[model samples]
Target: MIDSDLPLLNLRDICKSYGSTPVLNGVSLALNGGQTLALTGESGSGKSTLLHLAAGLDQPSDGSVHLDGEDIGRLDDAGRAQIRRDRIGLIFQQFNLVPSLNVAANVALQAQMANRFDAAFTAEISDRLGLSDLGARYPEQLSGGQQQRVAIARALAPRPELILADEPTGNLDEETGDIVLTLLLELVAETGAALMMVTHSPRLAQRLSREVHLSRGQLAVQ
Candidate 1:
């Protein structure tokens, strides 16, 4: 069970550097359950790097990240992978769906890995995203907007505690992006999950509950 007293996701004094070039320096933040936070910055401001660290795809040079009140830095690669599979949902600009899998299979993939697969749930999300009719289509067969919705559905199918999105709408047109963002906001709200989205658009950032700007490897409230 999650500890009620702890924030859903917390990062303290996070610092990451590749040899002599520092990407993040002393960055700290916390996200509570059901809260939506927007991360905005110019390119190369370490936004994606921060997301990667939080998602356990990378590690910090210093400090700790706690998810479900457990310190992830202490865990080995396999242990961290377990936490990620069971607790986090990731959506990326690239819409990383498997080419061989059909839509339905793609949405069910993560939940299957986490041992939480439910056909009903996957179908429900796909329907909500207007992808029920496209269940048999491959990722390559879909348009940009359709592909993004599919990514969102796949990330959200498992009902994770946190959602990490890195430029989730970067590849879409404005109208399509708006539709996708609206769906993401509404669905994530219904699931009561925390969202930390990285975007370059201040307009989109304003739509979230809170916004933070990352500049020069540091974060400042905006």
Candidate 2:
């Protein structure tokens, strides 16, 4: 039986390797609903690798990853894909958007894919992200900040319980980054979703509820 109160995302004794080269070794962490956690580390410390494992984008060599109390490692690729489409939201530094789609279509893409599209919620999020007037514009016509906002709207449009973000504000200038980070946190709180963000800035890490540092592929003390 699964516990309803279990952490939304859980990792136990996770390890990853490339051939014989170990990346993460015996790493464990948990993230509960509505909580925010920051993953921080130097380059090659496996921060992004850990995030990838959490998102089911990659598998670990050893250990278990549970999302909403279900063992993600046990799922097939299609199952994992479904989980991503229905339960998890992802934000990336590169602002992955479809160049051919206008802002409205891009924001609604994930929700439509899951067959859980909510028109009211989509409209609300569009306004909240300040994308209401850009509905007809394609990705190439938007500023970097606007593109990232569209990504944010797309992620949240599904109302996912867990959001995994990889250096979401890394490409922005400090001022824009601050604004976007603040908006991300606010939206996460509003939706009561747990956020696990991979960031290189200690200053940004402090804004999250908890910070986990990876040192030599191992989690340092909280």
Candidate 3:
């Protein structure tokens, strides 16, 4: 069972550096269930790095990251990978879908890998994301919006505890991006999952419950 009082994600004095160049310095934050946090920053502000640390994709050079009360930084590579696979959902601006796979297959891929595929849940997510009719189509067959929907569906299919989205709607027009953002937030709300999305758009960030700004490797609440 998930602890409601405890933060779903916790970062404490997190720091990262590439060689001698510091990327993130003493960053800390907390996220609770069903909370949506928009991480806003200019280019090279370490927003992506913070997300990667939260996802356990990269280890912090100093400090700790706790997900569900477990210190992810202490886990081994395989362990971290398993945690990422099982507990975190990641959405990228590029809409990283397998070109050959149809929508249904791509959406079900992670659940299949985790051996937690649920046909009913998958169907529900597909329908909710407006991908029900396009399940048989390949990634190339879809438009930018459609492809993004597929990515969102895939992320939610696994029922992860946390969702990390990096510029999820960056490539789309304002109207399309708004639609996608609405859908994504609705899904996150329905699932009661924690979400931290990196975006440069202040308008988009305003939709979230809270906003955090990253500037020169430091985090500031906004």
Taking the tens digit of each residue's C-alpha lDDT, what string does model 2 give over 79-194? 99999999889997778799999999999999999887999999987887678999999999988888988998899888888889998887677886787678678767987788
TM-scores vs. true structure, each candidate: 0.92, 0.91, 0.91
- Report the Cα lDDT for residue 137, model 2: 99
Pairs clashing in candidate 3? none
Which residue runs of candidate 1 sit more than 4 Å off their true CA positions? none
Q: lDDT of candidate 1?
A: 0.87
C-alpha lDDT values of all predictions: 0.87, 0.88, 0.88
lDDT of 3 by residue, 58-169 (tens): 9999999999899988899999999877888889777889998999999999888877789999998888767899989999899987898888778878888899999988
Off by over 4 Å in 2: 1-3
For candidate 2, the lDDT comes to 0.88
Position 11, candidate 3: lDDT: 96
Best TM-score goes to which candidate?
1
Candidate 1 per-residue C-alpha lDDT over 1-222 given as tens digits, one digit per residue, 9 for 90 to 100: 556688999999999999999999999999988789899988899999999999988999998899978889889999998887888989977788999999988889899998888889888888877799999999999998888888888888888889999988887788867876786687668877889999989889888898989998998665
Residue-pair clashes per candidate, as listed?
Answer: 0, 0, 0
**Preferred candidate (TM-score higher): 1 or 3:** 1
Error (Å) of candidate 2 at residue 78 is: 0.5
